[model samples]
Target chain A: MRETESAAEARPYHHGDLRRALIDAARRILETKGPAALSLRAVAREAGVSPAAPYHHFKDKGELLDAVADEGWRILNEAMKAAGENAPSPRAAMPSLGVAYVCFAREHPALYRVMYKRSRDKEALPEHLHEGEDSAYCRTRDTLIAAGADPSDPVGLELATIAAWCAAHGLAEIGGFQQFAHLKEALGGEEAFFRGVFEHMGVFARGLND
Target chain B: MRETESAAEARPYHHGDLRRALIDAARRILETKGPAALSLRAVAREAGVSPAAPYHHFKDKGELLDAVADEGWRILNEAMKAAGENAPSPRAAMPSLGVAYVCFAREHPALYRVMYKRSRDKEALPEHLHEGEDSAYCRTRDTLIAAGADPSDPVGLELATIAAWCAAHGLAEIGGFQQFAHLKEALGGEEAFFRGVFEHMGVFARGLND
Candidate 1:
């Protein structure tokens, strides 16, 4: 009886850090299988806890999904910030951000989908979502400014940033290997793809100077 | 009993023309309700038939979705072609095509999602789907050539076309109200949003000439 109880306690819900463990497990499953495969019971099982343990942290699936989405946004914001900090100049930094954006999308495809796909509104959105989005956008906008773009008339900068993001996000959303094939044949490669997108951003930026 | 039986008998397995009926019903539901609500049963019900009726015409939900996505491409191609047919020049035709592209997205958001969602495979895409996309691209490419763009350069043409589509599709995907807001702020209204997208298209084309 004592040995059986010990075995059961090894997977207990009230273990020292079950909540965070559950979130980590959920993220791992989402990254591997995609959002459609994510389930509370499955997550609990993977975390080596009882089936009912997840409810202690998340009221429902949406809450769990929202938490994941919020975390994705935070990761994105951090990546954008790091890209900005590491670039030598604005022009150099701008394309690096594009690369970072694509890398983030590819490396965390499921999380990216969870962040954007049928995203919850502000009311339902976890607390960190808006700040994360704003941080990412501000990083781009400020990098454009640092590159000699006018802070006063920022529309062109916004358009350029948006365009670069669109192209990178577009290519990445299509996936890596296939995107490499399609883009490399025509545009030279992933680097060239970013160059074209960044070049377009330049053109859009120059339009503002005019 | 006799009348009810006759009515039931009238709704045959072949559906008197199920393929066309499914397409039409799909379009109707897409326009009236939205894309998320779409289902084979809903489509069958809309056509006044049983759930099994759609299975005869389509293998599964994806097949039905693929059919609708194909239809969306065709409709978009037709709108683009019609917009380009009688413009003052290819330059003028380009913006018209851009406008029409946005219009299609706005009028059919669900179909728009079905068309652009990341999961769909280009290689496995149904024949009509590729045909419709090719036709749409040809219209833009032809317009670019007519507008003094180099005809020999496929690479430049594709880049310009992608940029154009991205602008239109992005505007459309963001929703109609935002389109109107963007237009009002930048172009003076949604009408101007169309102009801004094409004006940028022209900008990209001229970059080639330079």
Candidate 2:
């Protein structure tokens, strides 16, 4: 009886707000406990909502995870764009973007894993995520094309993009391992270690041109 | 009363065999059901053994996982060595080794994930896995030296090795993703996709020398 007409009108707005809150809660859980611990119920609990509340926003855990991964990609896309835009020249952007990609993974290891984890499950990702033109993958491809890569030859462009991406991804994945601690020390520090790898990117990009 | 001295004598051998079986069972589970499905009890059940049996071989789940990851590295080491040895020349070995690294991951996705997953855990990997001289990481280092990288300059050699590793690892991780399906199709097929990536390795290596 206390719930009046104004409260009813505000219900849809609350629903939208709850969806964002649930995604934020899921991200926190993913960062703290890793992907295995991320469940819709757990997210609801983290967000201080009832167990059934998350279902109104997400159909199941998969949908929630996909949302979290989408958020990760959006943040990553921004980081890569910033790195490219701040660089002095188009060719210089490649190594900056490479460094940024690895640095993003280092900063958000759990989120990085979740972003890539969707690829393992066959049906989880939406069609737009898979499309080359609209994805962060395209950012790398476009950067490569801008940086002296032959835009006309799609095959060559793809190969160059793959090589650059592989190098960045590999470095990011291994950067956090204790086994590589010595490499970091030997190279002076973490920044130096990253710089050394980026130097090789310059060599690699020049080689692509040749 | 029926358990006598002879049965006691047989117990040690059974322990050793069970340990091997548990590792094998864990590998099978990892490959089929993915790493999340891997648990000591699950592995024991998969191997047709008692629930308590795995505890006799591994202290806990972490110990069991480390053992499985160790076995994965052993297999990967052999694959890499075989690839390096089969190449006609020292310089020719780099791209071959790169291809082998990615192919090993492709062939054993779950095990590859486990092998890399150990790097994330702070204390799980054995000391031997960290030894620079004995690891598969060293194989890349050695190949770089063979391909005319200055072995005396450890920093430079390490950087080159990282570059090669990052490229290979990136390709392997994304190779299975549907996002790259169009790229693969454009390259003609899966084999051609791998071949294109390997060809870029040759260019990257040559650039390193210059």
Per-prediction TM-score: 0.78, 0.84
Report the lDDT tens digits of candidate 1 across residue range B1-210: 335656544654445788888888987888888765677889889888888878887888777777778778878878877888867654466667767888887666778777765233342223342344358766665665665555686665555554454556545644343313543477466556545544443232222123
Q: Against the true two-chain complex, what DockQ does each candidate achieve?
A: 0.23, 0.35
Write the residue-wise lDDT of candidate 2 on B139-159 in tens digits.
777877776666787667667
Worst 10 residues of 1 chain B by lDDT: B201-210
Task: Itemize residue pairs with steric clashes in candidate 1.
Answer: B183-B189
Off by over 4 Å in 2: A1-16, A32-37, A123-135, A185-189, A201-210, B1-16, B123-134, B185-189, B201-210
The all-Cα superposition gives candidate 2 an RMSD in Å to the true structure of: 4.8
Give candidate 1's total backbone clashes. Answer: 1
Top candidate, metric TM-score? 2
lDDT of each: 0.62, 0.73
Worst 10 residues of 1 chain A by lDDT: A201-210
lDDT of residue B13 for candidate 1: 41
Per-candidate TM-score, chain A? 0.75, 0.80
Tens digits of lDDT, candidate 1, A20-109: 888898899997877767888888888887788778888877677777777887898888778877877655776677678777886787
